[model samples]
Target: MITSEKIKIYAHYYGDSDMWARRAKSSEKAILSNDWYLIGSLIQEIELVNKGLASEKFTLNLKKHLIESCDNQETIRQLESLLAMNK
Candidate 1:
């Protein structure tokens, strides 16, 4: 489980379009570091934002990152459901 502070950090870091490339790079680093918990928090934040206002780019980026980093079937299912809900 990820702490709320970490979740906020992940959201603030990744939510900046000006920093997107850097964010993606950092996400790749997190993936390589095997930080699934942080990844999960990112996904959770994305889901929260998606529920309020959909951003196809952010959704797609998050989905791609989730697919790449997450191995848990349940998490993937939740991602799918979230995607479906936003669509």
Candidate 2:
């Protein structure tokens, strides 16, 4: 599943409210129990979902890292440009 497809799935699953409620309930139980096993599994599932989504238009694993890096680089560039103008 591409990112867009996963996003659509997420939207549908969340938008309906029923499925979302169930998911929320299960997650809450897991949290309350302090179940690291469940938590770890949930994290892996979310990561898989994200990976599927990002892979469609992005390079999968590096999507978030790249976005963060790009944002950082852009900020630095803008700061340097501003400083140059001030000088």
lDDT of 2 by residue, 1-87 (tens): 112222233333433335554665564433333322322233343355545653543444344433343335443233223222212
Q: Candidate 1 overall Cα lDDT vs. reference?
A: 0.50
CA error at residue 63 for candidate 2, angstroms: 22
Please, what are the lDDT tens digits per residue for candidate 1 over residues 1-87? 333333344344443434533555665445333343455466565766657665777777776766665555565554444333323
Question: In model 1, which runs have C-alpha deviations exceeding 4 angstroms?
Answer: 1-40, 78-87
The local distance difference test score of each candidate is: 0.50, 0.36
TM-score of candidate 1 on Cα atoms, chains taken together: 0.37
Which predicted model would earn the best TM-score? Answer: 1
lDDT, candidate 2, at 50: 46
